[model samples]
Structure formats: C-alpha cells, structure tokens
Target: MPETPPMTPPMTPPMTPPWTPFALFGALAVLAWGAAALDAALAGGRWPGIVTGPLRGAARELVRQRRRTVMPDVPLVRAGVCALPAAAVLAAVVLPLGERPVADLSVGVVWFNAMEVCVWWALWLTGWGVNSLHPLIGGYRFVAQGLAYELPHMFALITAALGAGSLRVSEIAAAQRGLWFAVWMPVAFAVYLVSAVAMAFWGPMDRPVGSDIAGGVRAELSGPDRLVFEAGRYLLLAVAAAAAVPLFLGGGVGPALPPWLWTALKTVAVLAVLVWARHRLPGVRMDRFTRVSWLVLIPVSLLQLLVVGVVVL
Candidate 1:
C-alpha cells in the first residue's frame, strides 16, 4: 500500500474575553444602594423606613438648591466630588469578577494602589475648593490621615503580592484557591481592613467629615451636588469592601453557588461591617488615630510583609 500523508493537528481558537463589564455596572449600582441603606440602618434601622431613607435623601437633595461659599472654586469642587466614585470604579476594574477582571492588567495590584492614592487628591480639592475655614481644616485633616494610613496600606498590599508571586488580581485570586491569603497573612488582612475604612474616611477615620467641623470637607455641598458626593463616598466604601474578597477572602471560590454570586455575597458582608462600624465604634480623633496608624499599624504591616516575603522565598 502507498504511504499516506501524516495528519496535522488543528489550530485552537483564542479565548473570547469579557472585555466590557456591562453587567458589573449593575452589580456595582446595587452595592452602592445597599451600602447607602446599610449606613441609614446603622444610623437607625427603622423597618421599612431604612429602605426608603436613601431614596428620600436623594430626592430632598435633588430639589434643594446648591450651597455656595465665598470665593468657591466650582470646577474644582465638581471635579473633586466626582473623583471619589471615579477612583473607586477604576480601582475595582482591576479586581476579578469570577476569576477574570474587566481589564486584567498584569500589574493590577499596582493599578489599584495608584487609583486609591487619588483619593488623597480628591478630598484635598473638595476641602480647599470651598474656600471656607472649616473646609480648609477638613482638607488638612484628611491629608494628615492619608499620611498615617497610606504607608501601612502599601505594605499590606505588597505582602499579598509577595505571597501570590504575581501582581495580577486574578492570579492572586487563583493562588488563594487552595488557601485564602487571610488564613496565613492575618496581620496584612487586619491592616487592610483598617486602611480600607481609613482611606474611605469611614467609621473611626471620618474626622475629615466629623461633627466638630460641621460636616467638614462636605460642609459647603448641597442639593444634587451633595447627593452625588454622598453617593461617591458610599461607592468608595462598597468598592473597598468588595476588593477584600479578591485580595484575601478566596474571592468567588465558594462551592455550590455561582462564582459571581459568591463574590457578591462576600462583598455585601464586608460592606455591612464597614458601614456598621460607624455605629459600633466611636469616631477616633485624628490626633490619637494618626499616632496609632503610624506607630502601630505601620510596624505591624511591615512585619507582615517581611514574613510573607520570607515564606515566598
């Protein structure tokens, strides 16, 4: 018989990626509303009343006239207020939704860090743009807080990246399939939680918007402007909480339920804790908290990073 031609293997097609997170937008919106409702309930959970609280507040702010201050920088104020949610959304884009991110950049962890650092600028502008004594003071307070928290936050992130051996958020999530980062990196996890709340200026770290300064950085905002500002704040909180999942909580790793749903559940749980903190813990004065952040949190995070580095090596 005549020799036959050898068969060649067929080429496999490339994977079809989820480039746009259109559905993620909806998920984030629900999370934003849930965060608002959680804060309202924390303030006072009055059955059905808490459910409508955010809506009612939004309506009230929408109809009310905008508050203006002497020599205010309207453009700066608008940009500053808008930056909070924008930063949050951008940072979130690098995180995984069921093992794949919207962008999936190789340096996703770095991307997340850079985006959050913008919060420092956002609050600073919001505080200074108003050209009021209280607003200026509030801006100063946030800058001080940022100095205290940012170092430790960086160390904690570095620790996670070290353990995962990759800066990509998806790889970090994959690394935790067997065991979550939080299991071994307790210090980093704890520090992350503290910094998460601090960066958002939520709970104990909210002195920038505290009672002492008549709502502080937000003192001059009103009407639709104020509404957007409040929503941005909550969105930051929600995004921070959601990030905890992919970073350390075995994101979308649960059995039985769908991965997306698991991610959402974990996110909501963390968001509730952060919002509830406002009621459970008294707001820390910047003077005392700043010292703790620098002296205690920074050292602890460094130790965690060192430990993680050694283990990875």
Candidate 2:
C-alpha cells in the first residue's frame, strides 16, 4: 500500500499541425500549373489543326474539297480563353487549406471576390476573341447573366464574412466549429449554390452554353482549345465546390481521415453533383433566368444576410 503509485490518464494522440496543409497545397499548385501551361501552349494556336490533322489525309480521299470547313479565329480566342482557366488552376494552387497563412490580412474577403470576378473576365475574353457572332452573343449574354447573379452572390458572401467577424476564409471555417453557417443561414447557402451554378454556366443554369440556340459560347472551338474550355469548366466546378465546402458544409470537419483528404473528397463529390445535373436538367432561357436571378435570388440572398447578422449578434 505504501508503494502504490497514482495512475495517470491515458495520452491522446497529437492532432496534426495545420502547417502541413502548406506542403500539400504546394504540390497541388505545381502539378496544376504544369498541366495548364502545357495545355495553353500546345492548343491555343493550332487547335483545329491538332484535332483534324490526322483525319485530313483520309478526309481528302473520301470527301470533296468543298466540304472542308476552315476553323475560325483560333489564335486570338485560344490565347485569351486559356488565361482564365490557367489562372484558376493557379489560384487553386495558392488557396489556403486547414488554416489561414496570413491571419492579419485586412482584405481577405476582397481577395476571394477579386478571384471570382476574374472568372467572368476570362470567359468574356474567350467569347470575344473568337471573332464569331455566336460566341460574341454568348459573351454578351454572359455579362448580362453575371450582372443578375454577382450582386446577390457577393451579398451572401459578405454577410457570412461580416457575421463571422473576419475576412479570412480560414477564420470563417473555424467559426463554424460548433455549428456550420449553412445551418443558420440556409437561404444564403441556397442562393450561393444557385448563383455558383449560374456563374459557372453549368447544368440548368447553362444558358451561356446553350446547345439549342447558338450552340452556346464554345461552339466554334475545336482541338486543344476546345479541350481547354472543357477542362476549365470542370476545374471551375471543382474550385467552386472547394470554396463552398469551407463556407457551408464544414470544411475538413470529419471523424476519420486527414483534413486534406476530406477537402478533396468533398470537392469531388460536389463536382459529381454538377456533372449529374448537367445531364439531367434542361437549360433555362436567358430572359427567364435573368428575371429569376434579379427578382427572386437577390432579395432572398439579401434577407439571408440580415438573418445571419441577427444570429451572430
């Protein structure tokens, strides 16, 4: 009894340091950059040639010369169109995970907004550069569509940031440790999701890529140029989903698995949903979409922000 010693509590394993995300992000950045650059350089100027070259000899023998269709505006549109997706891939590289790197940056929300705005610029340039009527119309339509959705989207985002009392995305994610913003601000989440689909021109919101009329903005592109746009769409969807994970679904918050894996899985799942919707939903008319965006989506998003403010206080 005299020799009996007090027993100590069992030790718990140490949580992985948040700094590990930096290394993971760096690797992702390098891979994305290399792929994007290679895609741009090879496909921008010679896309049609790249696509039809092998078939040309066979086509010459089987078809009349009059059947040959000259591919249009490969150089200009290709160069401009390649830049945004390239930048998006680059942004994905630098975006912080698990934690914010520079906590004191005052304009963190501004940074995210700026990046999102670039998506429209990149898309517009691609359409305009094509020097084709269909794409130009598509580009113009994109601008109009953007006007309809961007304000509401920004309001929702700003409300969340303001309510959380931080511009930092990491901080916003952290604030939802006890309860996610989606739970409290369900309307904002819904508005954000709808706007995100519209902004990316995906699925039912895919008026810009209308297969029925004008064949959408990317109708004229071929070869690697077409590939770039196609790939860019996927990347945009992936990035949007990734951004939303932290904002709504509780980023990397799970029982098992590391944080980074959880983030990747969530992003992939969102992309899958977009893909499914792309096949399932019919595209809406541009006029109808615009009206819905302004009349319905905007007011709802604004109200959601007000709700968030009340809950936060």
Candidate 3:
C-alpha cells in the first residue's frame, strides 16, 4: 500500500499576467512629453511654458526641412537617429509595468545593460555620419564617457542582482517587499542615478550635445531627423528613470494606490528630479569626470557591492 502512493503532479511555473505593447509605448510617449515640458519650463523660468512648449516645438520640427550637410552619410545618420528610440523601447520590455513586464526575461538586468550600450552606437554613428568636426568630437567623447561610467554602472546593476540573487527584474522587485534597495544600498543607488544621467547624456552629462560645441552630436540634425533624435533622447531618459523603480525604488509597492498608479507616480518623481538636475548641475568635462569615475566612483561602488554580498551571506 505504501509503495502504491499516488504520483505527485509535475511542478508548473507560475503564470505572468498579459500586458499590451501599446500600453508600453503610450506610457513612454507620455513620460517623454512630460520630460520635454519640464525642461522647457525650467529653461524659460516660467511655469506657464510647460503647457504649450513641447507641442509647439514638436509641430515645428515635424514640418521643418532636413538640412543638408556636405558628403553626409545619410543612411548611417538615419539609422542612428531611429535606433536611439528603438533601443529605448527594447530596453523597456524587461522593465515591469505595475507588476508585470511585457517580456519577463530571466536575465532582465543584463538585458537592460545591453540595450543601453546601443546608445553608444547610436551616438557614434550619428556623430561620424554627419561628417562634421564637432559632431565627430562629441561621438568620441561619448566613447570615452562610456568607458568611464559603464564599469561602475555594471557593478551597481550586479549589486542589485546579487542582493536579490536573481537577474529577473520582477524577482528583484519582489525581494524588496521588506525594504527598498535604495534605502539599504545607498551607494549603489546613487551610482545608478549618476550613470542613468550619463547614459541618457542628460543634465550634467550633456557634453555630447553641449552648447559650446554648437550642439555637438545633434548640431547637424534638422526637420524630421532632428525630431526623431530629440524624441529618442527624451525617451531614453524616461526609460532610464522608469527602470530605477524596479531596480532600487521597490517597484509598485506603495500603499492605497493601485500598483500601476504607484509606478507612474514614482516614475514622474524620478523624471522630475532628473530634469531639474539639468538646470542645477554644471557640465563636466569628460576627462575630469572620467578620472572621478575611475578613481572615486568605481572603488566606492565596489565597496558597496562587497558590503551587500557580505550582508546577503
């Protein structure tokens, strides 16, 4: 009788709820518009500018002509400009909306990093393809910047994954049910924020499109091409800001509000802080920033990672 015990059923993986692609893109569009409006308002020092500025600028760009450059690699420039937003969207796939991601990849943390690397490619191609000196310099600057920030950025990501002992973003978010990672892992959180800005080439990291270099990488862009590139930039920033929620801010874990609403609120808060930083922080030279990144940030992040590992053990 004991030997005839009924066989247990096979274990099935938990099912994830379905989410639509349109929802993902729609959220991104709204965030991008918000970022643009906020930046415009700050620049003008008038709160009223936030209402109509983004719409006015977008309409103008849509109808403007694509300004020609001498011996420009048109195809390459086109690819680069379009790829920026495409990369942003792809990266957002692994990021959970409320509690479910469009694609809940096992290695979501790694996936986000890989997609962000595409920004470097986009910048380089756009800079080089334009066949201009300042743009070329801007492209090279980003490469140097990448080398500087990417190491600490990766370590910060690894720390988050290590703390949860999972690469899946949702799992990581779940692990923080007790305490938000940003609260415990302050160093990693700070580094992540800094790298987020640098990756998007926003705020203090806008040397890639600095006014001194005549708009740098985007100097030659105009019309629809310019529109696409600018949209892509804002989109990248929005995605970066949103990813922080799952990574460090305890995604969708607030009280009272629905999970999705909590996610939206957190995202807006982060995006506002990032946009405000542009008006406050001074632009830094890539060389000096690189030195600080390697000498200071890298070591600090490594220490933070070590502390997290010990605590986990």
Candidate 4:
C-alpha cells in the first residue's frame, strides 16, 4: 500500500471578497482629482474651475508638444515616467480595503517598503535620463532626501509590525481594535506621516521639485509625458496616505459605517492633510532636513520601535 499522506486541513473559501484590481485604478483617479482640485482651491481657483481643472490640464497636455532634450535616454525616461504610479499601485497591494488586501501577502509591510524604494529609482532615472543640469540636481536631491527619511520610515513600519507582532497589514489593523497605535505610538505615527511626505516629495518635503529648480526633475517633460508624470506624483501621495490607515488609524474599526468606508474616510483625511500641507507649509531645505532626519527623526523612530518591542514582550 502507498504510504499515507500527511494530514492536512481542508481548504476553505475566503470569507471576505476583495475589490477588483480595477478598483485600485479607480482609487488612483479619485486621489489624483482630489489632490489637483484641492491644490487649485488653495491657489485661489473657484469651484467649477477647481473641479474641472485637472481634466482641463490633462486635455491641454494631450494636445501640447512633447519636449525633448539633446542626448536624452528615451528608455530611461520612459521607465522613470512610468515608475511613480506603478510603485504606488504595487505598494498598495498589501493594504487592505476592508480587512483584506488585494495581495494579502505574509510580509505586507516589507512588500510596501520594497515598492516605495522603487520610487527613488524611478525619480533618479527620470532626472538622469533627461541629461540636463537642473534635472540632474533634482535627482540627486531626491537621493539625499531618501537617505534622510528611509531609515526613519523603515523604523516606523517596523514599530507598527512589532506592536501588532505581525507583518500582515490586516493583522496590524486587527491588533489595533482595542486602541489605535497612533495613541501610544504617536512618535512613530508622526514620523511615519512626515516620512510619507518625504517619500512622495509632497509639500514641505518637496525640495526635489521645488520652484528654485523650475520643476526640477520634470522641467523638460511636456505633453502626455508630463500628464503621466503628474498623475504618478499624486498616486504616490495617495498610497502614502492610504497606508497610514492600516499602519496607525485603526484600519476599519469605526462603529457607524463598514470597514471599507472607514478605511476610505481615514485615507481621504490623511490625503487631505498631505495635500493641504503643500500650501500650508513652506518646503524644507534639504540641508536642514538631512540634519533633522538623522539627529531627530531616526532617534525618535528607534525609540518608538523599542517601546513597541517592549509592549509586545
């Protein structure tokens, strides 16, 4: 007789159905529009104009001429142009909408981190591909900013994972049912938010694309390329804001509405804050931010990690 196979649990269908991947695209579109409209509103644009502003810009770019620099690396330019939004989508794969993510990986936090790292690569490539002095400086600026923030960003994520005693995003969210991590782990939460801005190059952390450099990395881009690049920037912002929900805002634990709704509200709130900061706060100088990140943010984030580790123990 054949040896008996090892005993195994029977397979079971998942209780909660996840939204289709297209929903991810829809979320991206919504986020892009919101960022654009709010940016316009903050810039003193009125209601109807603010609402249609993003669409009009897209249309304008569609018909406009594409700019090219001498000796431009076309392939590298395309890679960088596409990377931002792609990274955002992939990073969000592990973030649950209502307690279940699109990917639901065992190491969702790690997955998210990996995707975000890709963004630095994307920006640097875009900057270098253009073969222009301003864009090149812009690219290096992003690298410096990344060095400043990536450590603290990683520590913040680790703190959340340690607090929950798991890397699965949903598990992290579930662990917060009693109390939000943001309450006790405020340091990490705050650092995470700040790093989110840095990671997306948004608002006060947007030195890479600052006015001083005349749009910096994207200065040479125009037409459809510019359209895609702008959309990708907002996409990264949206992903950063959405991740904060599962990482700190108690995921989907609100009383009145469904988990997905709660997640959406929290995400939108975070997104609004990130976008508002663009107008509310002047950008930080990279030189100062570099010092602050290593001296202050890193230490605080590490301490938050220690606190979470002790709590778990």
Candidate 5:
C-alpha cells in the first residue's frame, strides 16, 4: 500500500539506575577531602583561609578600634572557638575507623549521641566567643534549635539500637543481612534524616547562620581559626552521613562490592542529598522551626520508638 506509513518503532523509556545515598557521600567525601588537602597545602597550612581571612582582618581592625563592645567574655569565647575543630577531628578518627564487629561496641549508640551533644556545645561556645551581640543571639538560637531536633534524633537512634538488640553500629548493619531497616522502619529513617539536617544546620534549618539577620556567629573569625571551623562543618556532614548508612540503611548491603565500598557508596549518597537540599530550601524562621520540632518531630519520634519496641518484642 503506497499510502501505508512505515510502522513507528516503539519508544522505550530510558532505564534509570536506582539512586542511593551512599554514592553521594562517597563523592562528597572525596571532594571535601581533596579540597581541604589542597587548601591546606596551597595556603601554607592556613587551610580555612578561604573563609576566615576577611573575618580575621575584621577582628584585628576591631581590636585597634579601642571602642567598647558588648559581647560575651573573651576567654569563654576562645575556648568555644577552639573546641569546634577538635570535635571534628575526633569524629573523623572515631566514626570511620576499623571494620564492622571490630569497632562495634555495645555502647556505640550512646557514644554517637554523646558526640553530637558535644558538637552542639562547641558551636555555642564559638558563638559566645565572638563576644558580640549578633554572635550571642546566633548562639542562643542554636541552643533553641538544638532543643528542637536533638531529642527526636536521639530517640530515632534508640529505636534502631533496640531493634538490632545492640548499640553497636556494626552489629546493626549485620542484623540487616536479609533486609535493611529502611524497608521496615521508613518513618524512623525519615525522622532521622530530618534531624540530621537540622543538627548540621543545613537547608531549612540554617537560621543560626542566617545571612539576613545575625550574619552568623563565625562572622568575626579568621585565619587558622576560621579554617578549622569550616573544616569541622564539612567533617560533621561526612560523619552524619556515614552514621546514617550503618544505622538505618543496612550498612553496605549489596552485591559485587566489598562491605567498605558499599558503606562508602551509601555515605556518599547521603552527603549529596544534604548538599542538594542546602541548595534547594529557603531557611525556616527560628520561631517556625522551634514550633515544628516540638509539635511534629518529637511526637513522631516517640511513636517510632514504640513501633520499634513492638516489632522487636
């Protein structure tokens, strides 16, 4: 038939690979580590010069002013500022070292939670050390925000610990040999993700560093001090993503890959999500976050704990 058109080929949809959080973490870790190393090398060991140089100059100018300033006591502020980098180093060493079961401790869950608390305290100290009104306000805001997120986040971890019958992160990963906790406890995982973002001051929870209002607590920091704080932030992001993988997503459960590689993939995925979210959301007002945390996250976390108890029991 001259009029008959050739049969159109059926269009096939493009095959999309499943997206994983671990992949994002691995990529970000490499990027962050590389950048930090490069910055350290090029800047003559002044790694955080990228962020802190201006702040340091400003602080020096302020010191020369001879004018009175209303701020927290200087010594207290210095101590707090000093602690942030120390905490980051501790996390880098403690969280990712050793294989499963070898590094797994019965009290691992408690230790992880305690470290987060320490992070909160150190951030407050940094804010307080600025000894200026904006930093003080920013620091207090951080405290309030911490109150909103920390309890629910702790509860979510507890649920996982109870479900696996051990606080050890490696053991929790082992328990998910057949299935991931993400499949069974999606709600808890969701809550944990939200809390982690909030704790890290990313995305919708970044009011403490709100450029519009307080200009953030680190506004006055510079040189090595500033670099240390920024590095700590990146490391904190890395640690949180790493923890999420082992705790919730059946750490490194996969075919055709070693456990460590699998873990790396999962952590990378989580970090990417954090970075993506940081780019996507407008920060919530401080008051709005406080309300949401108290009214929504806390109750949900408690309910999740109850659900885990029933399932595990």
Candidate 6:
C-alpha cells in the first residue's frame, strides 16, 4: 500500500468533433463565393458587382432549363459534374483553416496533388460524355495542358517538400518560422503559382474553356447542372489559391492579425491576382505552351529544386 502509485489517466488521441467537416465545408464555400464575386467585380470594373453579380447569375442558373444533348451518357455526365466540387472540397481538407487543418493527414501534400488529378478525370468524363465535338476538343486541350504543367508543378512541390524535409503541409508552413520559402525559393514559388492557375484552368490558362470553343466543357450544361459546374470551378480556383499559402507563403504567418485572418487575407490576395490575370494576360495555345513547359519550365524547376536542396543541406 505504501508503494502504490497514483493511477494516471490513459493517454488517448483526441477525438475530432463531428462538426469539423461542416466547418471546413462552410469555410470552403465562403472562399469560393468570394472568388466568384472578385472575378465578377474585376470583369465588370465595379466593386458592387462583386456582391450582386455572382448571386444574380447563380439564381438565374438555378431556374434555367438543363439542355440535353443527343444520346448523352447521363451517368458519366452526372459523375463528372458532381466530382468536380467534390475534388475541390477534398483538396481543401488539407489546407489549414487557421492553425490546424480539418484532416491534418501526414501526407497532406500528396493528398492535395492527388485530389487535383481528379480534375483531369472529371474534365474528360464531362467532355466525352456529352458526345459533342467542342467539348471533346476542350477535354483534349485540358489533357494536353495537364501533361505540360504537371511535371514542373510536381517538381515545384517536391522542392518545397524537400526544403522542409516533410510532406505534411503544416510542417512545411512551420518550417518558415523566419524566412518564407517564397523568398528563398522564388523560382519554385513562381512555378507553383503558374501551375496553380493552370490546375484551376483560370486566367491565362483557360484555353480549355475558351470562348472560341463556346464555353468548352461547360458549353452544354445549363440549369442546376451548370450552376454546380461553375461553382465547382470557382471552388477549385479558391482551393488552389488557399493551398499556395501553406506551400509557398508562410501559411497563417503575419504581424498583427490572427492566424486565421492572415490566412484569409493571403488567400484573397492570391485569388485577386489570379482573377486579374484573366483580364491582363493573353491566352496561349496549348502546343506552344507545351514546348515551353517541357524545355524551359522543367529545367528551371529542376534547377530550383537543386538550389533548394543545397540550401537545406
């Protein structure tokens, strides 16, 4: 009895509250809406358009009729349309809302990249399922775009992961306690940003959905179908912008604001730049870009990765 020690409570992993997914979804929705609003504002050259335009357009789509194509593959079309937003949301799970992520998976970077790859599948499905010439071409365009951008993008991501010696996005963010990876790995950061636009098919990289092809993959969709697809695209763009914060920028790092506020501000800044780029930059053809991406981008990214490795060592 004299030697008996007090019993200690068993060490247990903390249980995530059930509301976590809902909170993450709510945050994602807000960010996506902000992106849509910003794009609308930039296009219209008025601040008020930001608030009203997106809402008005969404309302119209919700009530509009969904036009059916001749002998359309309904199941595939539905799957692709649904998967787009799902992939975007899944990708956002790794992105920390403030100081913590919803999932906080050990391989957050890989998870983000994998979810992004789903866009290729989604595009192909939607385009092919429609059984239309323009959509098919648009799908082909995206496949080509992905082939060109993905290698350099992967290298850029690897450079960051290598620098921090961790694939976990939170750890990468934590590694930049003093100097941000963007400052030192500027090349990688630039590459990452370019790939971000390409991944979202936004701004100058929007050839897949170019007006020349009459809305491309989304040309045939209408009503609620169109609404969901457009919303998914905005969500993808927002998620890409959000992912940049942890990968290149210092996540939630800032001087005065709370971490979550810092994250939101940084994300908005990135989203604005992406939206503005659409107005400023001219679209490049996929063939020309493919040549440049392979020759210039791949080599440059590799060199950046080498430089980062040296610095890390």
Q: How close is every model to the real structure, measured as TM-score?
A: 0.92, 0.73, 0.94, 0.94, 0.76, 0.93
| Runs of candidate 1 exceeding 4 Å displacement | 1-20
| Residue pairs that clash (backbone atoms under 3 angstroms), model 6 | none
lDDT of 3 by residue, 1-313 (tens): 6978887643432455544567899999999999998898888746666767777788999999988889999889988999999999999998888888888888899999999999999999999999999999988888888878999999999999999999999899888889999999999999999988999999999999898899999999999888899999999999999999999999999899988898899999999999999999999898888989999999999999999999999
Candidate 4: how many backbone clashes? 0
Per-residue CA lDDT of model 2 for 112-209, tens digit only, reads: 66666777777677777766767777877778887888998888778778667877666677777778788888888878777777777777877777
Q: For residues 90-166, what per-residue lDDT tens digits would candidate 5 score against the true structure?
A: 44332332234223345777877777767778778878766776766777788888888888898888888888998
In candidate 3, where is summed lDDT lowest over 10 consecutive residues? Answer: 10-19
Per-candidate Cα lDDT values, in order, are 0.86, 0.65, 0.91, 0.90, 0.68, 0.87
lDDT score for residue 47 of model 6: 70
How far off is residue 166 in model 1, in Å? 0.6
Evaluated with TM-score, which candidate comes out highest? 4
Q: 1-313, model 4: which lDDT tens digit per residue?
A: 4599776543332444545577767876898789889889998999899999999999999999989799999999899989988998899888888778777777899999999989998889999999998888888999999988999999999999999999989999999999999998999999999998999999998878878999899889899989989999988999999999999999999998999889989999999988888888988999987898999999989988887888889
For candidate 6, give the lDDT: 0.87
Cα deviation in Å at residue 287, candidate 6? Answer: 0.7
User: Residues 209-307, candidate 6, lDDT per residue (tens digit)?
Assistant: 889999899888889888888989999999998998988899998898898888889988988888888889999888988899999999999999999
| Segments in model 2 whose C-alpha atoms lie over 4 Å from true places | 1-76, 90-94, 100-106
Q: Tell me which residue pairs clash in candidate 2.
A: none
Candidate 3 accuracy as TM-score: 0.94
Estimate the overall C-alpha local distance difference test score of candidate 4: 0.90
